[model samples]
Every structure is written in structure tokens, then in C-alpha cells.
Target: MQRKLSKATTLLFAVTAGQASAALFEVDPGPYDPAIGSFAAWYQDTHGRTLDLCLSKNVSSRVAGAPGAPSYMCSLLPEPGVFDDAEPLVFPTNFPPEAFWFTADAAIADAASGIDLTFGAAIEAAFAVEEPAEGDQISFARIRIRVDVPTIGTYTVTHPYGVEVFDVTAAEFGADGGRAINMTRDIGIGAPKTYNGALGGDIGPFLRSVNGPYAEVNPATGQLDRFIGDPNLDEPVTGSPFDTNYVRIQGPGGIDLRTNLFAISGKLSEVVRPTPVIVQRATYSRSSGEAGLSTQQDVFAMAPPPPATAQYLDSAAATVPMTEANATGNWYGQSSANATPPATVEVSADNSVAIPNSTPTTLSAPLVDVVSIQRAEYSLNSGQLTLVASSSDETEPPALTATASSGAAIGTLGGDGATKTLVTGISPTPPAKVTVTSASGGSDTEEVVLLP
Candidate 1:
């Protein structure tokens, strides 16, 4: 017997035909505002730290209320207390250090009039798993553009990806006589509202023209409406594709005048465990007696918990445990002889079977040598012992510990391929022989030469 489908299913298929074809692309916004172009863009972290992403020519001149400057001037100046000026927004702070970040740039300019009339902007954002939910972490990017054109003229935007033309007419200066365009382009999983289920087929990461006053044929009413796009429907809307350039403005300036363009990335899914980061790796030989025995130490920079909730190290020799280092705020693991290369390191936020885990990383064998102790000397008057060491790898020096012949610990010191001086108390006195050991188990013992 043949079965007839419901009208809702049929309508869903019809709406799916109008799915958006554009996808978000990644671009480097460069250093916040440089002194070359009329553009300014920034990335604000959850902690309220702002980072400039483009070059700005006349940032000071485009201040609000400034003569000839647009009312919503793009200011490169960071907000006091709200913006972090000392350091840029780093990874793992706002975004998962392991997740991929995508960015895009769009600008229009007409410098033929002697003065630089540029409307350039960029976006740097990312989307990742928030755990317990898929694709829920949407780190939306703020798309800020500097509009410095005091006179009405046509401005054409061209970039490596696409180009668009905008005619700066009087109408663009809204009722308030100000030029401003802000809109958000988000669809699929983390959208504010659900569109036609399955029918819309993820038509997002693109500017939505329907949110603004742009004119488009309304699918519901079949008549031209200012709010033409329906976030609820998969119908065609007059907006810029999310990945290429900003949506084509249907109004006076062809700019979306509703909301700021905050691009969304990543797909809807449970948060995946963040990949383990191996910051440094080194191999060290055991003391002279233990020939052919070497130990490999791997220092890893652990990602913050939501994604890297738990971390572990697996190898042939033994499953090593990892712990966070208080000194460097990183995770450390070590394996000695008999352990095979290409060890697997994994992390997970959820130990249960419900959530997706982080991708396991294959750690290769260490190719560089760990630092080794070289010399030892004692100062009789000061009761001070000096230990010297050298490292083949200067970038990641091994930590060292010094001990006396009586097995009493003298002192611990960090290695920088330099001499380490430790003061021995009069009670312990100075031992005739001193032994230095590296974090990787490399050791060197030398007779202490007494000094005046």
C-alpha cells in the first residue's frame, strides 16, 4: 500500500531547496589598528580583553562627534578597564586552545578624492564544543568598520575572496543622520531561534537581510516586505554569504542596518576533548653505570577544563600519570627505557560514553638531549656550593636538583645553561662530593673543590 506524506513534510522539502550555499572562511585580521588604512576591528574575550585586528589610518579623527566622522565611528582606542591593553587576547582564555579559529575580512574604499574614504573591517571568531552540548560554544566576533567618508560617493570593496559596491546616499544616514550597520549572521545549531526544521538545512554563517529594512520578496505573504528574510524559513533572504564577504545591503548603503555581524562557526555536537599540547620533549642518558638506558620527558601545556577535563598518557613501557606543574602551569609526563615511540596522549571532559572525547595525540620520540650537570665546587668561608650545568637545547632547559654525599638535599635550582649557587648551612656542612640530578634522571657527581 502506498502512503501519502503530510503537508508539513512536503513544505519542508520545498524550503530546503533555498538553502544557503555560502560557508564561513578564515582570514588573518593582522595587527589591530595600524597607521595605514581606514579600518579597525577587534576581538573581545569573555574576560573583556579586546585585541585590535587591523590597521587604522585616522582612528583619532573618527571619534564620535568628531567633524566629518560618522556618528558610529570605529574607534581603535581600547575601553578603559574593559579592554586589556597590555597583552593580546590569547588562546585557551576565550577560546579552546585546541579548537580551530576562523576569520574573514571585508572592506570598501574610494581614495581617489585625495582623502582616504575607506570602509574596511574584519572578523575573528571561533565555535567549539561547550561540553554537555554540541556546537554550543559560539565565540561570536565583532565586525567593526571605520566609516570616514564625509561626502557622498560610491565605495567599492575588494578583497582576495570577493568584492561588493555600495552607493553612499543620503538615505544611508538613517533618521538620526548617522551611518551604522550592525547585524548578526548565525544559523543551524546555536541560532537564537529555530528556523524551519530540516527544511532550512543550516542556512546561516551568512548575514540575514530580513532582520533589517532591506526589501525582499516575502515567502509567507508573497509580497515585498522590509523584513523579508525569515529565520524560521529556509527561503532566500537578501544578506551576504557568511564565508565570503558581508551580505549585500539592500538599502541606501547596501549594508545590513539591523544587528552587528557576529559570525558563528563549528557544528552542533557534544564538546570534544581538547588535543594534548606537547610543548617540549627531551631525552637524557642515565648515569655512566646505566649504559643504553635513557629517559624521555614530555612537557605538555594543558588546555583549560571544559574540553580537557581529564588528561592521561599511554605508552608501551607503562601508562604514565600526568599532573599540572605549579611553576609553569603545564602538564608533565615522563617515560624511561623500554617505552616505545609514538605514545598516545588523550583527554576527556566526560568519562562516560555519552559525550565525544578529545582526539588522541601521538607523541614521538624525543630527539634533543636534556641538560646535564658539569661541575661542582664549594666555598668554605661562605658555606656555599656552586653547581654548573649545560644543555644542548637552550629553549627548554631541564630543571636540576643538588644533593650532598650524605643523601641530604642541598637545594633545587632551575637550569639555564648557567652556574647555580646554593648556600649550605653550617650544621649540614659541605660534603666532599656533590651530585646533581636533572628532572629527566640525568645525573652527574663531582668532588667538591674547597675554596678560601
Candidate 2:
């Protein structure tokens, strides 16, 4: 018996881009410390302030002296140092380190000093991808905005996604003489969560009506008497579910921090290369009667640059077979073309088992396939023709190539999915027709029809 499976394309509209290089600081994941508990991961800003994400229950002694420490948390200025003799907080178990990841950028100074003193920072994390036995593959992520402010003032932190303004007060400051205001969201693979997946706890720079000494600014009227403190003020914030850019601060505050966590299931087949590719794991079961069957598995990947050919590798590189029933095995394959989505890569696995004194049985199914070019537009003006192709993958748009009817290459665009535009200057008006091809081997061609 033989079988084959293909994944349906999922349309996701969003922009995905790379980050700028800067100084990065990382703490060595040494032996787990009881005092600090365990440092699962960390993100450090340009100013040297470190935010540690803990896996264990105890708070780091470095920040133990600070009042009202948080447990099972990632916050500012926490590091791995001397052990705190404090009792450890009871934390949930069975958490996997691979399920959580973090990365951040340096702080951008919005104000040098005074009431308008502020520094903007960005932090990001990658959570585990939830791939069910049936249904669509869902990726999960967390985005956090942490602001540290000294002195009472109104400030705003702006990133590629959205903008947030806060009126700080002395009472809001932490023991470090600074207030850490946080806004967080847990987003899934589909549309932006917006108001969904909001995790709010005790720690807060909660929504409070702005009063004297701090008046909110109104954009429409330029009124300084505008009252702030609406928790839902920045509703439906826009941001890619996978990545983030540097944050900028404005007004009278310092240390604005933004953090985002994304879910990664596999590595890109082109462009940037990530080490130790992330793979899928599952349990395989067989009845006792088929215990003596010999099995073989083969894995292959296909990605954009149309007419994408299948790239196959040894099953050992992609899978660790289940030696026994109900046991788990790891399976790796290429699932992404870049950091963000509109997943352009497709992965398939073929498993064959030889039955004792019988013909072998084979099963094939796509492991990954979730993005494609959903739409394309062409326009001509002043002898210049432009082609814009939109993809369903929001994270990382697959590379696209445009060709003229004369078989001449027009241009190719990729990287950011938000902006996949190709422009070319032609002599005799528009070409008779144009074809756009995606890296995933999908193509769309349309005849040029000019207005009379």
C-alpha cells in the first residue's frame, strides 16, 4: 500500500524582517542554582540591564533585596549570582527549555534626561509550536512591554507594531526607584490576538485616571488636559506574531522595554541558517502481531523559487524511530524559509514497514505546508510597470520572481512579506502578460489589460 499527503496553504498577511546588529550579552547556563533557581534564558539591553527568565521557583539573590519579587517570571535586572536563602516558590513542572526562547535588542534613547528622559528597548521570545494530529499547525508566542521610569511623567513607547503611553507616579515605582509597567499578549498562529490571550496579574502600572501634574496628550485637539488610563487604549496593536523591531521612547521616562516570544517549528531552507534545526516529535505504535516488522522512513523538503524540487536526506537525519509502541521519536525537517511566517516550505515523510511474509505497507503525509502567494497585482504608469504579490504567510514571505511575456526577467522580491513589490521600466507600454512565481513552486500569470 502507498499513500501521499499535501498541506493546504494558509493565508496570513503580515510583515517579517531581520534585526539590526548590536552588542549581545548572555549568561552561561551553568549548573542550576537553588537561590536563583534555574535561569532558563535571558535578554540583555544595550544599557547592560538584564532580564532573566527563570525555570525554577527561587528568585535570584541579586534582586532578592528588591521588594515583592516575582516567581516564574522574566523581569528587569535579575541575574545569576549568590544564592538567596529564601524559600523557593512552588512552580509547575514538566516545562521544557526548548519550548521557550528569548532575544532582545539595545535600548533606544528617546530623551537624554529630565521629565522626558526615556529609553526604548525590545525583547522577544519563541514558544513551542502546537501541531495536532488533525487540524492546522498552530504557533504560539508572547509579547511583553516593560517600562522603567524615574520621576512622575507621561511617556510613550513606540515600536513597529503599535504605540503605548503611560503616566508614571511615585507609587508605581519598584524598590529600585523605578516603575516597571508591563503589557503582554499571547498570540496564536492565525490573525493577531488583539484583545485575546492577555495575561494580567497582580504586578501592574494599572489603568488609573490621569489627574493633575500629569495630563494625557490628545492627538486630535492637542489638548494637555486629556485624561489617560484606559487599559484598552491600545487595542488591536499590530505586530507580527513571530518577530519584533527596536522600540523607541518619547516623553519623560527612561528604560522602555518591549519583549516578544514566537513559536518556531523548523529551520529555513534558504537565506539565514539556524543551528540545531528544531524538529517535530511523536509516538508511533504498532500492534503486537506486527512487532517483528522492519521499518524505514524517508523525509524530504520543498521550498520556494518556483518549481521547487524535493530535497531528500537520510531518515536518520530527520527521525529517531520509535523502538517500541507508545514511545516517542524526534523528526526534523525544513518548514520555514525565514524567521517570520507565510511558511513557504513543505515537508513530507514516507514510512514503510515490511510485514513478515507479506508486501510492505507505506504511508506518506506532509509534515509542513502552510503558506502561498494568495494574490498579485500589476499596475503601469509612465512606462513603468509595478507588480505587487501578496502571500498568505505573514511571518516570512517567500521569494518571488516576476517575468515579462517576452521571457525577460523583471525582478525578484523577498525578505519582508509586508512589502513584496517589483517594479520595472518598459519601453512599449505594459507587457502582453506577466507571471509571478513563488519560491514554493507556485505561479500566477495575468494578461495586461490597460484602461482605454
Candidate 3:
């Protein structure tokens, strides 16, 4: 099948027209997106100063695998920007900063075109646990980093999540610390989240008004003071979600032993996102003569299956349809070609199609088709017929060569002289009757089917 352009197209987009132009590079995500989700960077200071620069949301799980053991599109690393190795770009702070500890899990982009443009320093910031303490408050380190590239093309690695690369200008440190200055700051996190596919969790940096922000040193606070709500301090709180950019103070609670001397700035930074999964459709069929005892209610959530027959029969296979009733088994369920609604099954034993674990099953279905192939037209040139293969790839034209037929003059076909190879020119001299082959390996005998 012809391959089509995907998310990787932009990778090779803006390249100069020359031999020195940019080249496309493919990198495997390496089992990421699901396993280790995103990370939230926070600060908890010694003097009870607390702040959540990096917001955390109560995320929910969406993927529902086979019924036996629920699985999701597991990702090994947390995020490319955090989990992956990062070079510490120094903070040009005027004060002497002290302390830093970094965190990561893998999926990050380290090098581009084999070039090690990574930075690393020390991480000294607020954390959950406490370390050595100072007198009043603890200080942590922060670094602002960004990248600079001469030509325009998709960059493999970016400090931010969504953006592929940090577009910078020649001017460095123009108020906004970008490529020339090497810094990143603003970061947006995912809003709605899931909880292992069961329930959805809510996370935000706003201090819960009941106490403080959405989080506190002790309580799971979800609070924040509104600026526009009560312009006079008496009106009701607005429905707008809490914003955290204004609450950038170093977290309190014996966080850093060093002074307030850090902040990582960069051109761009991405929100740590999780891999998304879908719940598949599955059916349990017992059309093999006899039916099982219990119905859907019999579904043994934790009970061991009936030794021999149970395990082998994955009653949980997803998305299988009841098209046709084969002499052997039922064919795919018949349905209107236009109707795409998922086919349904019953939990009733009367139909004898229910399993003990009546919880229900569905087959893994695609939200959309990625690629499809269809038979196109059949064209005959001179004495040869050709079948065209049409599929996902439609960019460049498709061309297939043909073989000539025997006893037919090479000139039999006027224009298509350039295609055929073996059976060329009037079947290698008339009297020599030969048959040509088609792509499908089918044969076509020339006009003289009669006795040559």
C-alpha cells in the first residue's frame, strides 16, 4: 500500500531547495504516553510559603482493554520534556542561587541530528518531603532554557510539550528570554483528567477558598481568591476556573534551605499529557450446540474460569460482528451499508448467548479508519491488461510495468511501447506464439487462439 503523510509531515516542511536542505528523522516514542503520565513541579518553602507554578489536574483514564485485566495505552516515560534528559541552561540571576534536584523518566528528546544540545545544572526547589533546613526559608534552583536553529524545519526535540521546536531570533534577552537568551516560562496543563478509567479527577492550582488554594500543606485544598468576582469584596464568586500564574511565590514549609534565587525561563514548554485509549466492543457467543448455565449475572468478576474451556475461549474478544450465519458459524451481522452504529448483543440466556459475567463486552473499535484500499479501474493497452492498486497514498502517481504477449508485433500497441519487457514486439516474431502474464499472475493469450 502506498504510504501517506502523517503527523511527521511538518518534520520535513520548511527546508531550503538544495543538497544541504534539512533531512527527516524518525524517533520511536519507546513505550511512552500511558505508563508514566505527566509530572507537576511545585514549591514548598520553609517559612510556610507554598506555590504551584506547575498545575496538577485530577485526570481520568479513558482506555478500557480486555475485561480480564484492564489495560491502557501504557507509556513508559512521563513526558518528553521532563522525563527525558535535559541540559541545565544557567539562569543569569544576579544573586547567588543554591540547590537543585532534577526529575525525569525517559521519553525526552536529548539530541537533534546527532547533536547533543542538552543543558543541565542543579535543581533546588519545593518538594513534598523535607531535607536539611536553614534559618528562615529554604531556596531551590531553577533554570530557563531554549534552543536556536539557523534553518527552518521541524525540530525533533522541544523543551515544551505541544511545540516541536523553539523558534528564536538573533536578538538575545529582549525582555522576553527566547533563543538568544535561552529561556522558557509559560506552561499549560491538561484540564479534565481521569482516574484509572473508573472515575474522573479534578486538579488545579487554585487555593480552595475554604482554606487556601486547591492544595495546602496538609489538606487537599482547592481554593483561590478572585480578582474580578467582588470588585467591592461583597459579590458572589464567579464561575471562572482559578488561574495560577499570579501565585508564583516559592512554596512555604521548610522547602529550600537556600534563599529565593531561582526560576527556569524558556522559549516554550509543553504540558505533560497522557496517552488516550478507547473502550472496545466485544461479544460472547455460545452457538456451539449447548449453552452455558448462567446469564450475564453469572459473570465471575474474581472467580477462576471453568478450567479447560474458559481460558481458551476469550468471551471478551472485542468488536466481532454477527454478519452471516455460516454453515460452520454465524457470519458477520448483516446491516445496512450506510448504518455505522455498533451492532448490539443480548444478555439473555433464552437466546443462549449470555455469559456468567454478564457485565458485557465489546470489541476494540476504531474511532476512524486510518487507511483503506479499494479496487480501481482495469485498463488494456494493445494486448496487455493492467490492474491499478489504489490505497491511502495518493500523492505521486502509481505506475506498473507490463509484459508483452506472444505472436503480437511489438508495434501492436502504438504508444505503450515503453512499458512491457519480455513479450516485446509482435510476440518475438509472429510464428512464435507466446502468452503474456498479468500482475495477478493470470494469463492472456493473443488473438490467434485458433491454431497458429
Candidate 4:
């Protein structure tokens, strides 16, 4: 889960031998491959503007119940109070510069995350509109607000949550002369109550909870009854789905207003990503017959579930290069098209996979397998040392730790322990040493010349 380099080997690449040196060897994690779900950071402003939004993408989400749930992977925060009314909302000129890959995931998340994250910020201070009377099956949907003031710190207080009414606007919630940022039209959905499950009525944020018999009806009875022979209560009262698209802002004293400053669409995203394999159950039924010679026939049927595939990007399209431009600027997208194809390296316990003893090794390969990296020492024209990697990290797609001095090349593995590959294109002129450590405590060292 971590990327690091050895202390001693890093020194070998930085300074001449036999002299006291303080230069530290550093690991360079280049081109975070979002294809494999890696994290990337972005700042709305290039110079770390306090008022601009700082965003991180490709973060992993842990759902409370489902261990097998796809990680809901991404979010963006819209920071208010930081920006003054005079500040423009455009990209580059008034906003932060791009620091990472600019893909649909990042951009869309930039919008959607605001709604989800805002709801998240509101969750803590949220309380049931009213305690449910015993035995009442009511599911509530809510939209919460979080406000942060610099120096004074962040303060989240419960608000009487309400939905934006067409032709009607709620009183300002913040301060006088305060600016309101409206993202409602840009990202907001239809009225809050439009989809209140079975309860056909107007629904608003923090309004009345939805009542439900969220179940399938029996065809014969045309009612919320169970199948003839099957006896079970109606499905549990799952709350109605809520769509959030608008956020209202008010100045300091709850005076001025902006109805929708920002908005983004919500995605089922990774949480429900389809699986490659699915198990489906088939039910069979037979009728009862009277006495002696009665006979019955059994019917058999076969139905195979579709294979799960990538939800966001198709396998083929994800491999193709893409260039996208938004209001901010053009960004290089993540796709196999522009990426270096991973290399495959051979692992060995002896010299079987080793380079010639006296011949120079060119950085032609740029990928390696974790297994090929046995605990061993590699010597360059000047320096030699043993490197080890570990497999202790049992997390799927285990974390990799790598270290190298300046000019050292790094390779991307196809996957955990699948195959070994060398990082390619590094020259042998600078005599740099690269060490890769695994989560399982195994290590490998390769010394190569890296010329600029």
C-alpha cells in the first residue's frame, strides 16, 4: 500500500562514495493510472488559493454493510466562504490549475461529489424529523448543509432542510450581502417529492418521510399479497430514492442568497458495478394430485445471467487514448492509448533471469513480476546491495513500495504477483539503482544507467 525506496541504495545514486551526505533518496509515483483505480489530486487554483476548491479523486469508499460492494470511488468538495463575490468561476484564469489527469470520472465526480459530500457533512447533525411511532414503517430522505468560515473554523448546525420550490425561494440562510452560488439548473433534478416511492405526493428536503409497502404484487389478487404458496411478509420498507441537485447558500447573517452555486449528478458508480460472474436461482413447482394413478411432469429451464463488465468504461474503449477539454482547459486522459504497455519480466532464484555479468543493461523493459524479485543484491559499475519485497499486504491489488534516486525508472505491474516486468527507457550512464519492495517481504534490486 506504500511506495518507498531503500536508504542506503538511494544514497549510492545521489553522491560519490566515502563522503558524508544528507541527500535523501525519494520515490516517484508517476502517472497514477486511474484505469486501475488509483488516487489523484487537483487544486482549483494553481497557486493553492485559499478560496479555491482542493479536490482528490479515485478515493476508495467502504459501504457499511456489503463487503462485496464495489468501492464507490470518487468525490469533490465545493468550498464556500473562501471565494468572494468578485472572484470569477472560470478555469485557469480564476480557478486552480489541473494537477492530475482530467477524465470524465474526475470532472463528473467534481460535480456529483459536492451533493454527496454535502449530504455527508449534514448527516452528523441530522435528526429524524420526528421519532417514528412504534410499528410505523417510514423511511426518511434528507439533504444537509455544512458551512465553513476561515480562521473561525467550520461550524455545522442542523437546518430545517427544505426543497427549492419552483417560483418560490426560501429566505436567505446565511448573511446579508453574502453571495449565493446557484448550481441548481446546472445539476439539480426535478422536484424532491416526484419519486416518493408508493406515497404519491409532494416531497421536499427534510420534509415528511415516505411510507411504503415496497413490494411486488401478486398477479392473481392484484394486491400487495404474496404468491399463493409462498408465505412471507411484504418486503421491508426501504426508503424512497432521493436525488439532490441544488444547494442554497446565504451570507454570514443569513441575509444574501445564491440558490444554486454548484451541482453534479450522482452515479451508482462502483457501489453497484456488475460482477463478472453471477449466481441465479431457478424455481420449480408441481401441482398436487389425487390418489393412485395420478402422474405429474417436471419442467426444466436454463437461464444464464449476463457476465459483469466495466460500468464506467468499456474494456476496449478504456484502452484507447482520449483528450478532453472543459471550461478550465484541455487535459490528457487516462487510456491505454497514451500509456506505456506494461512489460513482463522473468523471476528467478539464480542467474537465469540476470543480465550478463560484464555487459551493460539498457532500460529497454519497464515492468516486472513480484515473484521474479527474489531477495538478492544487484551490482552496478559502482554500487551493490540486496533488495527485498513483502507480500504481507493481503488487500486486493496489494500496495507496492518502490524507491529510486533521480533518473531511476519505474514500471507498472500488470497486477499483484501476476508477472514481472522491467521499467524501460532508462539509460545506464548515470548509474542509478532502483529497488522495489513487495508487501510479502520479498525484494529486488536492479542497477541501470539513466542518462538525461
- Candidate that scores best on lDDT: 1
Give lDDT: candidate 3, residue 371: 19
Candidate 4 per-residue C-alpha lDDT over 353-409 given as tens digits, one digit per residue, 9 for 90 to 100: 111121111111122123334332334533443344433222222345556655343
Assess the local accuracy of residue 381 in candidate 1 as a C-alpha lDDT between 0 and 100: 79
Error of 2 at 288 (Å): 60
Error of 4 at 234 (Å): 21
**After TM-score superposition, what is the CA distance of residue 135 in candidate 3 from its true location, in Å?**
23
Q: What's model 2's overall lDDT?
A: 0.32
Q: For residues 1-452, could you state the per-residue lDDT of candidate 3 as single tens digits?
A: 01122222122212121110000001112222211121122222111112222222111132233443322111111233333212222221111122221211111122232222332222223212222122112222222333333332233332211112333332432432223324322111112111111011111111112111121121123532111111111111111112111111111132111111111211001222211111222222111124422111011111111110111112233222232121111122221122111222221111112122222222222221111111111222343332222211122112222333433332222222122323232322233233433222123333323222
Q: Over the stretch 1-452, how does candidate 2's per-residue lDDT look in tens digits?
A: 11111111112222222121221222223453332223223332111222333222322222233354442212222222322313333211222212222222223323334222222222222222421111221122333555555555565665433455655555555464343454443333342211111111110111112221123332334543211112112121211211223355555534444322221111001111111111222111111134443222223211111111123222223422222111111223331112222212223222212011212112233222122333333344456666666543333345778888889888885546434776566676667888877654346687765533
TM-score of each: 0.23, 0.24, 0.19, 0.17
| lDDT of candidate model 3 versus the reference | 0.21
Q: What is the TM-score of candidate 4?
A: 0.17
* Candidate 1 lDDT by residue in tens digits, 288-405: 2236344454534332222233344434434555564321123455555432322333322222221234344444443334455566767777777777765433334456788888
